[model samples]
Target: MPGRYTLAKSVLSERKALHPSELERRDLPADAARAVRSLAAEISVTLDANAATAATLTDPALLHHIDTRYRELPATVHEAMRPPAGDTGVTIIGSIPLRDDELGRTPIDWQQAAAWAGHPERRCASYELDIVMLLLARCAGEPFGWQGQQAGRLVNNILPTPGKEHEQSGASSTTLLAPHTEDAFHPQRANLLMLGCLRNPDLVGTTVSSVRRVELDAAQRDQLSRPLLPILPDVSYGTDFPDAETPPIPTLSEVDGQHIFRFDPAYTPLDDADLDYRTAYARLTSELERVCIAAALEPGEVLLVDNDVVVHGRVPFSPRYDGTDRWLKRVNIRLPQRLRPAAEATETGYGQCVVAPFRTTLGIHT
Candidate 1:
């Protein structure tokens, strides 16, 4: 088995270089940006140090106590969490206050924090951030994770690492991440994905594009709705997971009038014989990039993405690796009813789901 860096190097060696100027970029609307900044300021002042401390306590009893306390948050904070009316699939809550100095430098080693059993010392400010995410997610659905993904941690760290900066994984910092749904290979992928920034000194933006924003003709939409696409597991899932030869699945489906999408351009293999599917997929990816929105999240800010409706990726940025680079904490959420039967018992209380057997031969999970 090779190291993550080796795998990243191999992948990078085969790809052509990307020019930064060719990338797409967009900012939040002025009104929405202003509202979020103001709300974050107010929440910073309202949140007490005690709340931060309570967030770090993982005891079930203590977590319950903290949950009760957060439920009593001021009306203003609650209102800020709600997105403005419309069909936008991505929500940005910026300028939330974080005591970065107290949190110290970015971690050089990922294993310490990426483990299923979390690191206590790393929770200083991220713990409070996760509490906010948990509350927001509870309003819509339950948060979850996979035991085989990012060590099955509820709050996974997103940052650039030494050798993985060019890989398609979230740890990559210098590579263009092809837009895709989070863990699209799974049947029970998250309904919502939440990202909380801890340190983004360079102001790197996360790219997001929604299905609602992408214009498609009736024929194209119909083509995409057919079961003709095969999505592979993310590199982070390691190579040992099973079911790699599963049948092709639909990229888009309508359930109760709501559209659901599963896509990963980097991982999904193209079938030259299926001309219609290939053409439709190409158009879909192009539309997604055309309407892509880049949100530069700052410390204390959180971005909530409707994974079922939109695909997301990050812009390429150089990593200094000086322990002051970009850093974020991520979590996945799914409605309880959406939890698959096979993963229910294992993922219920704890977010750890059973990894499928597909693509287990890659030995990348290590």
Candidate 2:
């Protein structure tokens, strides 16, 4: 029932519709849909067996894949990436070079890519990006999703988009990024974030991440797991505009004795019960400073971050206002078996959020 949904009688009965993005307006084209189905089938076979019902769930094969492919990074590099001595919440595998066959190139802009949505991978190095997502999901033992527009640039190309960008230079003018999760507004969020660097700006823009180190004592663990902390989203991230009124979700959620975390200091609102909020915040900052490593990824190098356990940020990137600028591609995925449904199935119930749209809408009428 938690993953089920009831269908609305008709379009008129549907609640107010949220404005869909230009990309969302056009659902996956036939070929893309077929590709996704194939991918899904592959995932179902690899995962789905002995998955966790509530808390931590992982497939043995998935772990083995991560351990094996992780060797792509040098032993020294991987060892250097361990989240400090006391840290355990996050693990970062850096600068894993993909096979030459695994790499693809993107078009100069989004318009060209959209015209051939049916062959998305053909549009813009998307096939390579897809492989990156697959690897990350396989590592996290979680299913993931492709996020935003495949070929879209991080910043608006024509006019600078929101969240303050250097006007003349077209670079990030600010140094400090407000801490926040990638897509808190969406119920169906990406489980992992894969960043592939196409260019670097002034050799800056180092990534910063915070994690609740595993060595915390019982008291610290309790503090990390304290109930009902408000998670406020940065206004720039999305329209939800989270505030104090939004009930707090767990920053650290556990199941089957395995702990998982979803934290964004910028968006996470504080409640009275959050006694160690400041301490946790301070410790995280210290850990990030001490453990943060930078990889000036070449065109073919990709970095994968565990989203559920790691909060990521970027140091300021100074743009030169030239065609050559810092560029990175991101993709997200979800492990369906790890997710819990909001409610139980009724006589007529909607499925999980990802599939619920089919229940009330004219089944992919788009």
lDDT of 2 by residue, 1-366 (tens): 101211111111111112211101112234433343244335434443331210111235533443355345323433333222323223333333334332233323333323322252342233324334444444333333222322222111111123446221122334434333555434455545555554443444334344543344566556666555554333333334324345555556565454466665544444344447657644544554554433344443444455555555554444444344555555454444444223111101111133111012111101
* Best-performing candidate as measured by lDDT: 1
In every candidate, how many clashes are there?
A: 12, 26
- lDDT for predicted candidate 2 compared with the true structure: 0.38
Q: What lDDT does candidate 2 reach at residue 67?
A: 37
User: How do the predictions measure up, each by TM-score?
Assistant: 0.73, 0.51
RMSD of 1: 8.9
Prediction RMSDs, each to the true structure: 8.9, 16.0
- C-alpha local distance difference test of each model: 0.60, 0.38
- List where candidate 2 sits over 4 angstroms from the true fold: 1-163, 166-173, 178-181, 184-187, 205-215, 236-245, 271-276, 337-366
lDDT of 1 by residue, 1-366 (tens): 123111211111112222123222223344544444343334433544343233332335433533454455444445545432235577665545456784566775456443312344454444545555555544445555567765544557787888887778898988877688998877667777888788888778787778888889988998987776456677787654333454567788766566778887766666422888778887887788777767677776777777878888887889997878888888676654432332212222222254221112211111
